[model samples]
Target: MVLDLITIGWRYTMDFRRPTTTAPAQTPEEAYRQLRSLADESALRNLGALYSMAVDDHDIDTVVAMFAEDGSFTRAGHTVQGHTALRDFYIGMMDRYVTTLHIPNSHVITVDDDTATGILTGQAELSLNGTLMMAAYRYDDRYARQDGRWVFAARTLKFMYVVPIEQMPTSFGDSKRIRWPETPYAEADLPEALPTWDSYKC
Candidate 1:
């Protein structure tokens, strides 16, 4: 009897330390707002997936259509704004690759009414001048609702590594991991470049 009482007392202490509270029921307006937010987030995620599919298929028109009229895309310090510039940029990029496959992963998005932002990490396999290259990359994106649809407002691409598939074994050890054909070796732009990574080192 004494042991049972001790066990019960310990259980009560734990329950008091970690009290549980029931959440208030949502009103109809609150529920509707939540559903809308979920739909927007789903659309925003589809934007990234569709982009990868279009790029791999060389469907430049479809890729460009995913962006807002005034949207901008930036890569390697170059920024192209508006649909015309965006189209030209994508065309030029696609022309360099014989074929490509992009796999997008780990997309995190935040919705704030009609506007949102996201970060996407992905990898790609490209046939550049007959040399197969593997690349790990990330995209920082801003999105807006245009004509009741979510479209990219701006996107910036950054690379963690882009090396010839054959050189993958040794490339990670090299300080300069970006080994695009015909271009000078360049440093990777990722984990090490992240501010949080640096903060932890200190």
Candidate 2:
């Protein structure tokens, strides 16, 4: 589905810094290269927002289709790989969310020919068990061009904090911090080849 550009335009436009110089490219080849790079970067950034929208809408099919055939998604120690695994992951875990809003803060992507790496920061507000929670998170991603389109090769998410809306204190002065803890992926529930964030370069 085509996401509303206005929904994400503020972040995308501000984050993608076009070359300010009006100096003409030294050669036609250089001009073409610059244009190609810009296109790739735009596509990559759009993919990031699209992915979040898929999650928010509980559109797992679109999410899976956005990935390469062998792509993987990892977050909070749960890793799902390929279409089959992703379907299982979403059906059993992702679909449980009653409501969600994923607002992307920024996505900084570095493109290199057909391959790219990016870091994305965003806030996720979700309802669970009738309670609202907001999570500040980051995604470390790797992308590759497949069949003339950018697809996720791998995406790993790290959560900085998950704050309960009702219980959030007015201040945190000397208060103990709360954050997601590391847990090993359930071997019996997921594929054995689930990759880690460290395996990808960004």
Q: Pick by TM-score: which candidate is best?
A: 1
User: How well does candidate 2 score on lDDT at residue 34?
Assistant: 84
Give the Cα lDDT of each candidate.
0.81, 0.69
Measured by lDDT, the strongest candidate is 1
lDDT of 2 by residue, 54-140 (tens): 888888899888999889888756678998997788776575667989999877777888898777888888887677776667777
Q: Give the lowest summed-lDDT range of ten residues in model 2.
A: 185-194
Q: How many clashes show up per model?
A: 0, 0
Off by over 4 Å in 1: 1-25
Compared to the true structure, candidate 1 yields what TM-score? 0.85
- State how far residue 35 of model 2 sits from its true place (Å): 0.7
What is the C-alpha lDDT profile of model 1 across 1-202, one tens digit per residue? 1111123211101122111323343798877776787799789889999999999999989999999999999787778999999999899989989999999988777778889877788999999998999999988788999889999998888889999999998888776888899999988876665544556556
Alpha-carbon lDDT of model 1: 0.81
